[model samples]
Target: MNRIEQLLPEEIEKRSFEIISEELDHMGVILPEDEAMITKRVIHTSADFEYTKTLTFSKDAVAIAKELIVNGADIVTDTNMAFSGINKKALSRFGGEVHCYMADETVAKLAKERGCTRATVSMEMASEIEKPVIFAIGNAPTALIQLYNMMQTKQWKPAFVIGVPVGFVNVEAAKELIMETELPYIVNRGRKGGSNIAAAICNALIYELTRNHQ
Candidate 1:
């Protein structure tokens, strides 16, 4: 089995099979009594992609940021420290416009020095940004709720969201948000995946999309 498959717990594996079956049923993909084989195939298919990588935090963020730019992301939002760092290098290397949102002025200034177009913690500005924004949120559930509500009110339907909530608080929040919104997104599994992991997943998606496009 691949690394991801090995990482999957028995419960998650069972749950994934159920979800796949439900989705197939919804799509009218009828199947016979070969449910066990189908489940194995589903698990294998799910594990086909490599989602995470081990890199220095900065390198990880930069890699993801480049992918976002390539995939036509105009504005990149980093609500946490690690994302801010990654987004900074990405903005510099990609030389496109990027916006950094943070509660701390120091972080914002750092982001600015690294080539961010605007750095602020203002939700209003975020709400006003145009569509197809790339949102990277940390592990705070309250923050996720607020952002989601803000986007809903503004009618700003993001094209994609990269959720990498690292700690206990943010990880649960991220999972809940994913299950609730069902929006198109990429997420890291478990609390072990902090800002860097989230950035990496976003990077992987960007790379995947870019390769597919080319």
Candidate 2:
């Protein structure tokens, strides 16, 4: 029989991080403070420690993301689930908002007319936002590909990007494409990410901002 530890509602998250930190230490994994914060949150969300190896970050990606959020940059996600999981209230505190255009009627129409996936068209729509934007893409490789093209052509440059789409298709290749660029990014290097993980990373950054203000 397994013994379940009792915890208060507020204590659960703190305790979870305690366990995550202990396990990381036991495994001899050492990470920079900011990286460890994001990694721990991802592990807390997925209960998978393999992220310690698979999660890749461009230099100062976490710091850049936090600064963007602080400057009221908005976030665009590939899936509604990721959009919904973000803490809108906390983001609002920093004058930021989260958006997901995947369900927009216009995006669907454009994708159909162009014969491209809605994810592809959605990136184009996101580019038109007249503000600094951070993209959190976790379910569509097409979205990542589109962003890569947009960046290469100088059509749009995001403040930061989180590319962790999950699947067996072009998921790995898409991640590689983003990693090849000089843009700031945090990507799970293989095919093991999902919308939920993407949201976890966003929320981790938001939570860090909130913690600092407190």
Candidate 3:
């Protein structure tokens, strides 16, 4: 079987529901009764994908970066919070020239200390990177738009885009932006995905893409 077909369907459904429930709770309100009726609709829309993967924490992020490196990814962008628990050492140990980007200064310093060659929040820096940008923005569509605009203006084409936005706002919008590109991409289905989960999805995408290529 292809790797995608081998994924456990039941486990995927369980994980998707858990993620959606957690995100809705975190949003501080349940959907209106009308919207609630559409719950199956949402799930059905997302589940059309043939592959699904779940990620928990830092180790997942490290594993993803390693997989991307093995697949010949040249640049990796870490767009999560500064101290979001991703293992920098694992990314460093993968032994490729990986570029890291974060929104916070302390996180950039930490990534640098862990052997990331370049770190910055500037979209201009992203333009200069020579490899595909593995972008992980935690459910912030505005931020994703900014990045997209930057790339569009510069006419820079990344090898692929892995977008993981896990939050209440613009999750779907961000996913749409990534999807519109028609590039190889990965994303979580709904809200409640924080930076950690988003990173995990990226990791899973890397694993899938690398395995497929091999």
Each model's lDDT comes to: 0.48, 0.94, 0.48
For all candidates, the clash counts are: 1, 0, 4
For model 2, how does the per-residue alpha-carbon lDDT over 1-214 read when each residue is reduced to its tens digit? Answer: 3597787999999999999999999999998888989999999999999999999999999999999999999999999999989999999998998999999999999999999999999999889989899999989999999999999999888778899999999999999999999999999999999999999999999999999998
Q: Higher lDDT: candidate 1 or 2?
A: 2
Candidate 1 C-alpha lDDT tens digits along 116-135: 32222333356666544666
Clashing pairs in 1: 139-170
Estimate, for each residue in 178-211, the C-alpha lDDT of model 3 and write its tens digit: 5665455545455544455444444433333345
lDDT of 1: 0.48
Q: Which lDDT value does model 1 have at 121?
A: 32
Q: Which ten residues in a row have the lowest lDDT in candidate 3?
A: 48-57
Q: What is the Å distance of residue 170 in model 3 from its true position?
A: 2.7
Model 3, C-alpha of 160: deviation from truth (Å)? 2.5
Q: Which of the numbered candidates is closest to the native, going by highest TM-score?
A: 2
The lDDT leader among the candidates is 2
TM-score of 3: 0.48
